[model samples]
Target: MKLLLLLLAPAIMFASERTVTMKVSGNCGSCKKRIVKAAEAVDGVKDAAWDKKTKVFTAVFDDGKTDSASIAAAIVKVGHDVEASKAPDAAYTKLPDCCQYRDRTHD
Candidate 1:
């Protein structure tokens, strides 16, 4: 039992919950939904939110299973540009017209 406890202790210590925030390009409510859904879909992500006004994507995840880079990749896959990863033009072009933020001058 003592040996088992020792084995499990390191894993427990390393499996920490972490919160991360990063810039993600998006325009409106549709973009917000897509961004949040993509971030939360990662294996260890517990919750995610995006503020359209700030273009910030925030996520809570288990560090042992995932990280900020992985979360950003997920967002990029769904047509949003994250600080750590940029969505391909193919993916970006698929976003609905109103959800597109790149061509907007003020964004």
Candidate 2:
């Protein structure tokens, strides 16, 4: 009975959601629209907003289903630069001229 109680306790104590704030460089309004849209598109993301002043993306997501790093990666996947996340080289190079965010390593 005690073992069963302890196992259940951890589940009940776990968080359901988490909020994250992180930077992603961008140039203009189009970047804002694209970044915000991509962050919201992830399956477990609950909400997302971009701070133009700080160049940051703020997001809330279900902890049980998602995480901040994955959210950052998703943003990067769509052609932006987050602090710890990066677009794959091939993906970065394919962007239209205006969508390019930064120089990436050539392979």
Candidate 3:
């Protein structure tokens, strides 16, 4: 019984469902695809979606391997606006002229 329970413990401890939402600014299907794809690209991200106009992004992933802020950062990496998160200089600089957030603070 002890051996059997020990084997099952790891699987039970590993079971988890992590989902979160974020704010991002945009206005088109192309933007949606880009933002969602960025978030989903992270390891352990099971899914991602966004409303381009509202900038709300939803993501489902495994918490043991990932977290919300990192996911949000990834979306910003591909040239989308995350509400309170800033994209890295290299990532932000790569944005299309129009996609750029135009905020000095983001630097």
**Top model number, lDDT:** 1
What order do you get sorting by lDDT, best first? 1, 2, 3
What lDDT tens digits, residue by residue, belong to model 3 across residues 1-107?
99999998987798687999878866566667778788889998998888655567899998877888889878877876688866677876776655555542121
Candidate 1 residue-wise lDDT at 65: 93
For all predictions, the C-alpha RMSD in Å is 2.2, 5.6, 4.7
- Global lDDT of each candidate: 0.89, 0.80, 0.76
> Count of backbone clashes for each model?
0, 0, 1
In model 2, state the lDDT of residue 61: 94
Q: Looking at candidate 3, what is the lDDT of residue 99? A: 56
**lDDT of candidate 2 over 47-66, digit per residue (tens):** 99886657888999988778
Candidate 2, residue 19: Cα displacement in angstroms equals: 0.4
Question: Which window of ten consecutive residues has the lowest lDDT sum in model 2?
Answer: 98-107
Error of 1 at 71 (Å): 0.3
Task: State residue 61's C-alpha deviation in candidate 1, in Å.
Answer: 0.9
Query: Between the candidate structures 1 and 3, which one is better when assessed by lDDT?
Result: 1
Q: Which regions of candidate 1 are displaced past 4 Å?
A: 1-6, 105-107
Rank candidates by TM-score, best first: 1, 2, 3
Error of 2 at 81 (Å): 1.2
lDDT, model 3, position 100: 59
Q: Candidate 2, which segments miss by more than 4 Å at Cα?
A: 1-15, 103-107
- In terms of TM-score, how similar is model 2 to the real structure? 0.73
